[model samples]
Target: MKICVVGGGLSGLVSALELAGTHQVDLFERKPVPGGCLGSYRIGDYWIEEYYHHCFAGDAALLDLFDALQVADRLVWLRGSTGYYVDGTIHPLTTPTEILRYPHLTLMEKARLGLLTLRSRRFDVQALDGITAKDFILDNLGSGVYSSFFEPLLKSKFGDRAGEVSAAWLISRIAIRSDRGAGGERLGYLKGGFRHFVARLEEEATRRGASIVPDTPVEEIRREGDGWVVDGKSYDAVVSTLPPQVTADLAGLDIARIPYQAPPA
Candidate 1:
């Protein structure tokens, strides 16, 4: 099978690598360089990613991939701190005492918030799918918690459309990050940067007979008989790893009214 994987990010490269042995793969990237959000810069003696990134202990596939790429030795465990800045003061809220000292939420409210965090893993998030996080906070935990606590978070994470963000997404996010320690959350990072992983993945995929085309964006796609036409080239199938809105625009589909498809924060 001939496959055209779009976006040439980690997902696209990995997908192409996984299929290259049995299929003809052509990976296309819009940017001059690949890695998508995982791009990096050379800082002093080493490289660092442009965006903040870390792996969780629960990320088995990522660990396996790192090991397979022979970059496992570079993976290091680090404590990721959580804190807030208020009135020019930085408050680290990792420990129990710091949380208790936070003047915004009362003891009861803080307890309830912790309970919500604990229950997130078991919560029927689908029930809150259509409900906004703002409404969910106001209804379940009351206005004090919403205005004092979650409001800033929602605003910072979702900006102007924070009120329209679904409760399910917030709950699922909390659940996924539930693993914690006394200092902070334990996160994995490569000693240099994740760009090494991207580089290795690209190398392996190309070595396996996949063609990676950088600086070539698939602006157009159409179904052509049994195959698909991406740009002006035809292939058996196309895999798009770009954001939903971008993908929709490429395919000439309208999703403007879809709130979930709103641009990332």
Candidate 2:
């Protein structure tokens, strides 16, 4: 069967790879560069992520993906320290000693904050679904802690929409980054760049007879008779990783409205 996967991000590339050997697969990417947010920038002699990203020690699936692409040797674990800029002062928050030395919050508040960060993963996320992060922080750690610390983090991450963010989402984010060492958090990065992994995935998929088309935006898709019509070409099936609104617009279908927060600029 002929298959077409839309939006040439990691998901699209992986899908095309899985089906490449068994069927005819054609992947489409709208951008000139195909890695999406995982794409890299070459600075002088090195390549780094356009945006910043690091993998945690608990990232089993990500490690598995690296191994599958035969680039496991490039994986490097590095200590990444974190800091907070409060009231024109840079406060390094990596070490427990640093958090203790900070005078913004009382000893009790600091203890409460540490406890909250540690318990983030074990908390019942459903209970926090409807509650705003602002409310959650204020209720659990008091106004002093919220106003002095977490509020700044929320504002930096979500800007004006921080008040609308659910406690569940915020806590889940905290949980994902909980792998901390004495000095800082241990994060995994590829020695060269993640672009090597992307290139390998693309190369393997192509070697298995998949066609990856770049700079092609799938603007139209219609279910006509039995099969699907994709950008004037006929395909037996379709898989799309584009946003709901975008896919809905392309297929001329009415989809249920979902509350989506605009990303930080």
Candidate 3:
């Protein structure tokens, strides 16, 4: 079967790679280059990630993807430090001692924060889908933790739409970062850069007979009888890794709106 994959991000590329072995695949990316959020820039002899990313020991799928791409050996485990900047001060929150020393929330607030971290993984994420992160934090950890601690983070990542973010995403993010050590959280980074991983994925997928079309925004997606027509080309099936709302708009479907935040320019 011929398949059309829209939005050539990591998910689209990976899907293309997986399906290209037995099916004809075409991946469309609006950007000049693929990788999407994992996109990078060439700095002289090296590639630097446009957005910073790191993995925890718990990132089994990511680690597995690295190994599958034969780039696992390039992964270097590092102790990543974190800090909170408030007023004119930069307070380190890398270790337990530092977290305890930070003078933001009260001891009780700190206790609640720690408990939330510990309990984050056990949360029923599906049940949190209807609730906002701000409400969840406010209800469980109080306004101080929400305003002083999590709000800034949400703002930094999500910008103005931070308040609309669901608690499910927040809880899952906290759960992902729960792995810690004596010094700090153990983080994983590719030695050269994640660009190598993205390149390897593209190469493998292409070698397996996938066509990657970059700088091509999918303008149309309409039903063509039993199959689908993307732009002017028809495919046996269509897989969209684009944001749900964007896909819905392209297909001319009237679905409930899902709030989305585009990456910063």
Q: Best lDDT goes to which candidate?
A: 3
User: How does model 1 fare in lDDT?
Assistant: 0.85
Error of 3 at 242 (Å): 1.4
Judged by lDDT against the true structure, how good is candidate 3?
0.91
Provide backbone clash counts, one per model. 0, 0, 0
- Ordering by TM-score: 3, 1, 2
Q: Please, what are the lDDT tens digits per residue for candidate 2 over residues 1-265?
A: 9999998888898898899999999999987767776777678987787777667888888788888888989988888877888789998887778888888999999999899989998999999999999999989999999888888888888788878889999898888876675777788988788888888889999999999999999989999888899999999999987777778889997986555653221
Clashes of 2: 0
Q: Write the per-residue lDDT of candidate 1 for residues 1-265, one digit (tens) a residue.
A: 9999998878898899999999999999988778887877776887778788898987889899999989999999987777887778777877667777888788889998889888989999999898988898898898999988888888887778889989999898878777775566788998878889889999999999999999887889888899988989999988888777777888776756355532232
Give the per-residue lDDT digits (tens) of candidate 3, residues 1-265. 9999998889999999999989999999999989999999887998889999777899888889899989999999999889999999999999877988889989999999999999999999999999999999999999999999999999998889899999999999999887786688888999998898999999999999999999999999999889999999999999999888888999997867887777764
Q: Which scores greater on lDDT, model 2 or model 3?
A: 3
How accurate locally is residue 115 in candidate 2, as Cα lDDT from 0 to 100?
A: 95
Residue pairs with clashing backbones, model 1: none
What local lDDT score does residue 204 receive in model 2, on the 0 to 100 scale?
Answer: 93
Question: How much lDDT does each candidate structure score?
Answer: 0.85, 0.85, 0.91
Error at 90, model 3, angstroms = 1.1
